[model samples]
Target: MSDVVPVKLRPEILAQRAYKQGQPAPANSFKLSSNELPFAPLDSVVAAATGATEFNRYPDAAATKLRQALAEHYGLTAEQVLVGAGSVSLLYQAVLAAAGAGDEVMYPWRSFEAYPGMVTVAGASSVQVPLDRDSRVDLDAMLDAITDRTRLIIVCSPNNPTGTYTRQDEFERFLERVPSDLLVIADEAYIEFVTDTEALNATRLLADYPNLVIARTLSKAYGLAGLRVGYLLGNPRVLNAFNTTAIPFLVSAQAQAAALAVMQEADSVRARVNEITMRRDEVRRALIDQGWPIPESQANFVWLPCGELAERVDEILRQGGIVARTFPGDGIRVSIGEEASTSPLLAACARALERYPYLRREEAEAE
Candidate 1:
């Protein structure tokens, strides 16, 4: 045997942390971790997926038909659109296209856990700006972190974990301050759950900002998490870079067809979103009433700044047959799916409070 082991790998890959996906509980257990839509795919979408052909052939490299549908739905042209296996995949591709060795990518810490992993995997440095007291992105800090080596900035509106969004005017101001040469990614994976009229629509900003890219997914509101379809909208040049970095045949034919069908039934999707919003409101109110530290969530999830109580709360919920996402030192994030009943979530919260009275006492003292 050779004295040296035969291994070829970048040091960055070794140092990188793997993405922690939401856990899947046993059948019939309430799964409120991944922020999946509460409803199932429309009949049209189901039929499209089931009847998908061309399994023997490669999927459309361009995803032309789906691109056209998305463009029309978003009032953009086909050239301005690109589809990927999912928003996460598109995020990885965008990071690769924009940043490399010695470059820095800026994003809010605790916003998206995947940001750091993606940046590190691309052989770039990650600059995580801290969020504000309200758990919203600290725009001033983010601006200060920008250096000549900074090549990309990712903004997750209605940010994951926090469920708070940057207001429209604030976003416009930030856009004005950011350098025009740097690529700005607006990841709106939870946009469908947003009910705020004043929220910034990242797609509308694309025309004014050539470097802007909006990454959206069907995994959330469209109830197609399993199908894994997502798209990016941006300038033709930026999109070309994304395409060059993307894996070939990344999006399957069935996913593409299902996404097209989902886009066509916009009304049905909106209705489901309305239902989720109602449940989200109920859950938020119940938590606050129980003296839990709950933030105003615009996403299809609620964030509890319970800190160490997160693990305990997660355990209680799991024991109660509901699985929620816990971020260790951060907190817990519970998805507001259609199947998520207010009674169960409220009961879980109450049980957690009962088990850990100090959590409630601490919040009370802080207030």
Candidate 2:
């Protein structure tokens, strides 16, 4: 496996590295690195996946049944729904359908790491707007970055790593400022974990804004991370254009079945999501009380802005039997997991703060 290739490849792609996943944990450790649900697969979900015996045949290329179920759940027509292997895959398809070389795709930085690479694949450029001190999307700065070349903008509410959400009213105002013709994707992969009523749920705003498309996934809340299934909702005309770029039969039959079955257990999903939200708030509060300068997280994880000490802190957490997602010099995101993992996570952070007292200083003071 050397760098020597038999044929030419895209230089930009070769220059970029493949996506790096969160580190795996040891046998005895808690793996909170990926924002995966800690619970085991539900009985119904397991049965649904196992029942799909016809693996010899290709899956429905359009994912017709799964799309219909999702559409009905949201009170939208089936045409408004478009299923994919995962929201990540749908994101790639949408990007490909929108922009190409010389076009600009706008989204907040430190949001989804995959955005830059995906845009590059589409032969487009990324216009990253920096997040505010609280790690929330800086709407004003993003608005100012828009130009005639801007074709698409991705808005990640309860944004990744940081876990800060965009307020509904603020986002509405932000939308009003953007060009009507441009596409605005609201990536709400973790929307189920949001307890704040003020949080932006873009599906509600879809009818008013024909330019809007909402991306959601069952992988997080439905406890089907292995299924690799997600869906998009938008005006049928806009979504149809996106559909043209999709990879055929990307979602397996089992994934569709699991998604359909999980949709029936709404109460179960709500209870589980509620638990994570409570744990998320508890961890955020505990870190703040410990003088760790943690941001309020509205998602299923809490962010520790460790800056240069991110790797060291990550090692510390691992040693304490909790593996978290680390961003080198930036910070660490610890997903809310089983109740048992909570104490070890907090203890590790408490110890980390004691060792690096400078990290506990007020933001202004630390600078």
Candidate 3:
């Protein structure tokens, strides 16, 4: 028998690195690596999920009812809404719909790791604009990176890892410089957690920018990460493209029901968001008080810019039965979960600081 494999995968697929998600630690450990909502789904959402009777049948291919709910929530029409399995899936779909072989996709480096991978998988070239010193998206640099071949530009505000947001004015300036034909995807996965009124809501910008697309999810702030439900809002033409590329019945009946139910309970969701915001601030202050070099996080997490000290801090936290994300030579990203989660993380931070005083000193000196 021949030992050789029968078929070779696509060149682009072969060249891409496997996407890595935050690690899941032991059950007893405080799982703070993934930026998931600490609270459980509200009673209304749970009831909606259980009350869904269509599990025996295929979900609405277009997710009509769910889209309507989202449109009403965001003051958009159902025609402008496109639902997907998750924002991650919609991201891939949007990139695929915009760019293909020979085209280029540009985004901020270390913003969303998925951006580069999605571009590659869609047979497109990736141009990464490095972040600024503060680890915020360098809008000017990203605009400079754009070329005729550029088909899509992704801006992840309250960016993952860095947790920095691009203000409205900055975003508007960048948008003015970009070509109208190019698709601009604003990934607002952490939008609900943002406390700043000046933060740009891509949805509000959509009416003026025909090529703009905004992807949002119930995963982070709405506590529906496990449900894999997210939606995209954009011009009818752009949304039509997403609809063409989307998988049929991508969102499940239960997920749709829960998402719709959650949207109905806006006040409840806002209350939960308020709690998370307070906790996030408290955690940030606690870390700063301990002399931890943390960044200003508008998301539900804090970023420690300790570079090589990231691994050591992660190990220390792990030993205390807590898990934080370590970006090897970059830094650490710690999620602010429930009070139960934050207590252990705060204690672990104290222990880590005590054990690695020299590392902290080095970080301070380098800064």
Candidate 4:
């Protein structure tokens, strides 16, 4: 509870904590806390953003050209695309549009930490289905949790923090079972990092399901995190409803230009993503070899299931000049950054594992 305010405010709002970004690392340490791209922005993208120097004017309220380009890339009409500051903004708009007091928003627990807060801000309840033993979203369990009050469902593929993805077949089955009138958001924020052929892309099934929408961002693969460009692809009507709840001209002109430029730099972006994904695999393999019991990661990060020793592990990594995102009592999320980060990251994990030998899967099971 907070101290008394001068004016009245929603009790729930008072109780709710604000979203916290990943911690900043010291100068000598690699900040692997946020799952950010390690590479610098492409020259073309930077030039385009700087070229939009009309500071006196507001951005295009509709973001028409960028939306059209994205539509063309995805084989859809411009109206089917709704661009926003970032995918997170679009998600909040969707929740506010579809849910309200007494309504429920559903998603996997231990998924994106932002899910519950979005629901709360919408005056809606959150129904968090627990992840399976492998830390993957359990689609069957999600289907079983739907209630009449449920207004929105979010499925995060290559789910945040854990780095595990939903299978395409399982997702299709889950979507088929979802009520046609209900809205389902496939949050593919980290889709570009996924190397697994069987991982759910969501866009492939967008044509078949009007109730389904895809939320994606250029932040990860295209390295546009600072510009905050993201979009939604789905039925035009559904996007229209979401747009109604959006703040006007929130996407700046520079951001729109950067988005357009980045779209055209797909080859370069893919190459960068390939390097990160390869590095991610190598890091995961090394950790597993060190008996850390790392989960199979399809995203640009790996999960270290440190359990109650998360704080200690985080400290050890910090001491080794590596800063990872640590969830107290849960685990750590080590992002795939520059190749130079690998040695220190591995060293930190090895030290943690040696100190906490029971953290290994085999050791834990035997205990």
Candidate 5:
């Protein structure tokens, strides 16, 4: 591979690498890196996806049926719903629609890894406010960071990797202070796993905030990651702007059918979600018992704040047949996997703590 290119390309794109995904685990290992559901798809969902046989024709560009379903569920008209390949895709559309050169997009740092890249691709500068001491997004800092050039702001509840959620009152206060003309996206991709009654859902405040839009996906809770069915809920005018930026027919026929079928199977979906949330709580408690400074995660994963020892800790987990998402200097995000994985996960954490005694919060803070 040569660095030289025959054609011109955006220098920013040239300097940046494509998004990297979680590493695949060995067949014998428990793969907990990607935060995917371990359960199988419900029979009805599979049947509906398989039943969509029109491979030769393009999917409904509008995703009418899926939009109608989502709109009805939220008590909104169909115009307020915009479906896309995934919530990530919808986010990209939002950024592109609302921002450009000389503009800015803001979000919490150490939140979603995708936020910075999205801003760069939109030719907008990123304004990332650092998280608080507890690794939670500091709403006050985000409000202070906002400027006239800031066109959009994103708030990811149950923030990825950190697993912390913004409280409902805190979020409402932040929204009240934010400029009403600016667009704010509440990325609730992991909201389905949250058990905290007071956590910010964002949907409840939609009618009051015309500038607010909520992005959700069937990926984590509904086990529809492979199909990439996600959507945005907001004012029709705002949603229409995002829709204009979307690549037509990006959501496939199979995804729409699966989404429709799964929406109808709400009882079954809730059961599966409950199972995972329970397991998640158990894992967090066990990690805390082992002296790990695990954050209270409303999402389906736990964060191990390994700091500078992240790479070493990842090696320890790997040796225990656990493949987790590791950020070299930050921390490791271990998904709450099968019950069979619990023992090994705990064992690995114990070993790591033994080998590096300073990793525990009390010891690390003393340093």
Candidate 6:
């Protein structure tokens, strides 16, 4: 592909690749690529969505009812919350609202794959702070990377693809160091899976930092990914700015109703989240015992850092009927899916380690 453009599209947009989703599994394989809940949408949620039959009427641009539910759950007022099609959409809005051509939007690299795209779409330069050796966000490095051009800094807890997180104390210290005028977004899309009590919950710190915003989604825990409903908690004024940048009626009426319904199903959602977390820990431990250098994943996915052997391992996973997410030269992220996926996934990993012994911890140390 030449770096030539046939039309008057933005050069950045032309050079940039759109977000590529994980590969789908074959008929007989388990799809552990996307970090989606293996469970189906709750019957109550489905009924609520279906009940929103007035398709001809435009959805509430304000997303009032859903926002109210979220606000109530968070012990905040409706003015402090902003709902969007999904947390990713809200992230896009936040970037666009705060940044433009000359500004910089910072986030940990190897964090959310969507962060770079959102920054690009907002016409802002992306400053990606490299993750630490453990694949966790290095708050100190991020603070060091900050400069006058910085407008927004996004912190993804239980970071996507890696499942690492920033702790509360360090995060608060980092927040304190950040320029007060600069906007900060805490991306908590996988928060429900976090078992660590010390983990950063930016929503709790919202009252302390007017510039801070917390973005969360029902897509992960509530099985609302298909419905596309997520929201933000922050200063009413800041969220108001974000709302202005959002695509009108982005959160569909069905989505709103579904979100509202799911909010009431907290007990069931918690139970499912607990199941995934338990499975994640078990899988991670099993991989470790097999001499694989798997990290401690608090989220509902485990990252296999295969380094240069990523593609080869990906093919191996596919061969074993386990469709995990592969990031070429980086690593493979296997979502904690149905219990049925466990045996095949571990078998594939074991096979990969046997074929590429260098990825095994013992083998690496021997070298």
Backbone clash pairs for candidate 1 read: 38-338
For model 2 the TM-score comes to 0.98
lDDT tens digits by residue: candidate 3, 270-354: 9989998999999988888887767778998888776677888889889888888888888888888768877788888889889
Task: Judging by TM-score, tell me the better candidate of 1 and 5.
Answer: 5
The number of clashing residue pairs in each candidate reads 1, 0, 0, 0, 0, 0
lDDT of 5 at 181: 97
TM-score (all chains, Cα) for each model: 0.95, 0.98, 0.94, 0.98, 0.98, 0.97
Query: Who is ahead in lDDT, 3 or 6?
Result: 6
Badly placed stretches (over 4 Å) of model 2 are: 361-366
Model 5 residue 228 distance off true place after TM-score fit, in angstroms:
0.2
Q: For candidate 1, lDDT tens digit of each residue in 1-367?
A: 8745479878787767798889987776787888887676689999998889879999998999999988988899999999998899999999998899999999997888889998988899999998988889888889999999999999999899899998888888999999998889899999988888988688778889997899999998888999889999999888998899988998899998888888888889998989888889888988888888787899999997777667877888887777889998778998886554567778888898888876773554576
In candidate 6, which residue ranges exceed 4 Å CA deviation?
Answer: 1-5, 363-367
Candidate 4 lDDT over 15-104, as tens digits, reads 888888889999999999998999988899999999999999999989999999999999999999999989999999999999999999
Residue 211 of candidate 5: its Cα lDDT?
A: 99
Q: lDDT by residue for model 2 over 239-266, one digit each (tens)?
A: 9999999989899999988988899888
**C-alpha root-mean-square deviation, each candidate:** 2.5, 1.2, 2.2, 1.3, 1.0, 1.6
* lDDT, model 2, position 22: 74
- Which order, best to worst by TM-score? 5, 4, 2, 6, 1, 3
Candidates sorted by lDDT, best first: 5, 4, 6, 2, 1, 3
**What is the alpha-carbon lDDT of model 3 when measured against the actual structure?**
0.86
What lDDT is reached at residue 56 by model 5? 100
Error of 5 at 93 (Å): 0.2
lDDT of candidate 2?
0.90
| Candidate 5: regions farther than 4 A off | none
